[model samples]
Target: MEYFELNDGNKMPAVGFGTYKLTDPEETPNTVDAAISAGYRLIDTARVYTNEALVGKGIKQNGIPRDQLFVTSKVWISDNGYDKTKQAIDSSLEKLQLDYLDLYLIHQPYGDNYGSWRAMEEAQAAGKIKSLGVSNFPDYQITDLAQFNKVKPAINQIEINPWNQEKATVDYLKSYGIQPEAWAPFAQGYDHIFTNPTLSQIAESHGKGVGQVMLRWLFQRGIVSIAKSAKPARIKENVDVFDFNLSDDEMKQISELDRKEGVSADHTDPKTVLRLSKYTTNLNGLD
Candidate 1:
């Protein structure tokens, strides 16, 4: 698999397996194991996802050496302060059964993010976290955090798909030397993405699936993507994007399909911040 060199000088997988909704105790670990067996090295989980333990189980079951896998987890809003975030990091390590994480991110932009960043910096210095980043942060917030913090964020994980291209944000991130990682790369199948006429035509030409076309598009744009699937076939299919290449015309055709719409919660909305803050996790009983 191809890798992106982070601003911090760490290497991250270009394609990863996302575990956002893989919550079933029996299914989560098995699917994670299947993904690794299928050649996925980057495995993403989160404290809020409440499945870190299961993800850890899958990693152990996969029997791959710890150094060979790239594991990532996030600290939730409830654990936003320095003290709380510090504890949250240890809690995540315990739950993930990992001595260190490849990447650790501030899951959202709310609460005392500065405090959270400080804690993460400490963790990194202590060899607990390899890289530090933030998710769902706009250009301004990320810039502010980077300007004030000693360590600039190595990555910014956000929604990037056919519907919401995030062109300006992506451009800004690239210019700033920060890697942009795509979550919801397929837009979570929104607006019948897999069956869209434009993508379908492109896939037909490439002899691939619509999902593969989407991932290839992100790859050509120099964006890292994390795709999730419970089915073993689909999981394997998701990572099979390395073989094909989308032509310039096909890439433009897919870009034109962008509706400038987002599938996930709007980080700019106040209600989103309030709602997310209200949702608490049991990580070290922070709530």
Candidate 2:
């Protein structure tokens, strides 16, 4: 698998296995184990996912040396502020059962992020985390954030897929020397992208499945993409993307399939933000 060079001069795998919408604790451990055994070195999870301990267990069971694996987790808004963030980092460690995190992200742009960033900076300095970043943060938020912090974010995990390329946002992130990563890359299989005439033609030409074509497209664009699945066979299949390459024509045509403004939720709407914030709370242990 290819890796993206971070601003701090470290290389991160361009493709990772994500655990989103996966709340079953029992399923998480085995799913993670299957992915690691199948050659996935990058595993992305978050406190909100409520499966960090299971992810850690899977890694330990695989007996893969800690250095060989890249584990990422996010701090929730409820854990914002300096002291709170510091506490949250330690809590994440307990959940993941790790000595240090490869990457720790501030889960959202809300709450006392200024304090949160400061705490993240401290965590890096103390070697509790190798790198730090944010998820779901827009350009303005990043701009507002940089004014106080000494460390720039290493990566920004956002929504990027064939339908919602968000080139403008991608360009803005690049300008800050921050790598843009994709979360819901397949749009949760919501659209006809799987069988679109253009995508199908591209897939046929390359002798790859439509999923492979989409993955290849994201990788060719230099974005770190986290694709998730509970099925073991599918877990292995998702990472077998290094063998194929998307052509310039195919890439360009696919890039044009952009649906300019399509975040998974209406991030601009206060109601949407309020609704998502609810996930930050205890979630009644249901999540």
Candidate 3:
């Protein structure tokens, strides 16, 4: 697997597994087991994902050594600020059942982000986390936070996919030495985006799935992508992206599929931000 070096000099697998809505209580542990068994080393989770404990259980059940796995989690908007963030990080670590996090991110641009950033920074120095970052932050949020914080974010997780290409924001974030990690690299199958005619045609020609085509496109673009799959077959399909490379023409064909529409909650929307903050997840919900 290819790895991207963050600004702070840590190496993260360019392609990893994402556990977002995958926190379904009944399905998470087995799904996580499948992912790790399939050779996925990086697992992304959040307090909101609520399956950190299950993820931990899977890690233990699979008997994978902790150092061999890279786990990423986030502190939510309501838990922003130095004290709260510090507490939240510990909460996440405890939930994940790990001694140290490979990476931790502020869940949103809202809340006391600056104050939270300080805590993230201090946590890094305190050795609670190996890397720190922000998720769903805009370009200005990237610049604003970087200028003020002593320890700039190593990675910025954002919504990215064939339809919602974040090229501009990716460029902007790269300017600040922040690695761009994609959260929804498939656009959640909206509008049949991944299975579009052009993408499928390209995949067919290369004997690959449309989703695989999209992942190849992202990898070629140098963006670290975290893809999700609850099914075992799909989980293996998602990670089996390293064998093929899309031609430049095919890559541009895939890029032309961009519609600039997001599948999940748009971070730029205040109402979306408000809604995300309103819901508090527990082991039952997040599991």
Best by lDDT: 1
Cα error, residue 252 of model 2, in Å, equals: 1.4
| Candidate 1: RMSD to truth | 2.2
lDDT for model 2: 0.84
* C-alpha TM-score for every candidate: 0.97, 0.95, 0.95
Cα lDDT of model 2 by residue, 1-287, tens digit: 68889999878988899987666767777788889888888999887776777788878878889988889998887888999989989988987889999999988888889888899999899999998889888888877776568998888898899889989888888888999999888877866777888989998998877777888888888889999999877787789889988889889989888877564775667986787777763552211
lDDT of 3 by residue, 1-287 (tens): 77888988989987899887775666788889889999888999888777788888777778898878889998876688889888988888887788899999887888899888888888888888999888888888888888876888888898899889987888888787999999888887788776588988999999999988888888898899999888889999888889988998998887787788888777778888767777664532321
For every model shown, the clashing-pair count is 0, 0, 4
- If both were scored by TM-score, which would come out higher, candidate 1 or candidate 3? 1
Off by over 4 Å in 3: 24-26, 283-287
Q: Which runs of model 1 end up more than 4 angstroms from their true locations?
A: 283-287
Q: In terms of TM-score, how similar is model 3 to the real structure?
A: 0.95
Winner on lDDT (1 vs 2): 1
Candidate 1: Cα lDDT at 128: 99
* Residue 49 shift from truth in candidate 1, angstroms: 0.5
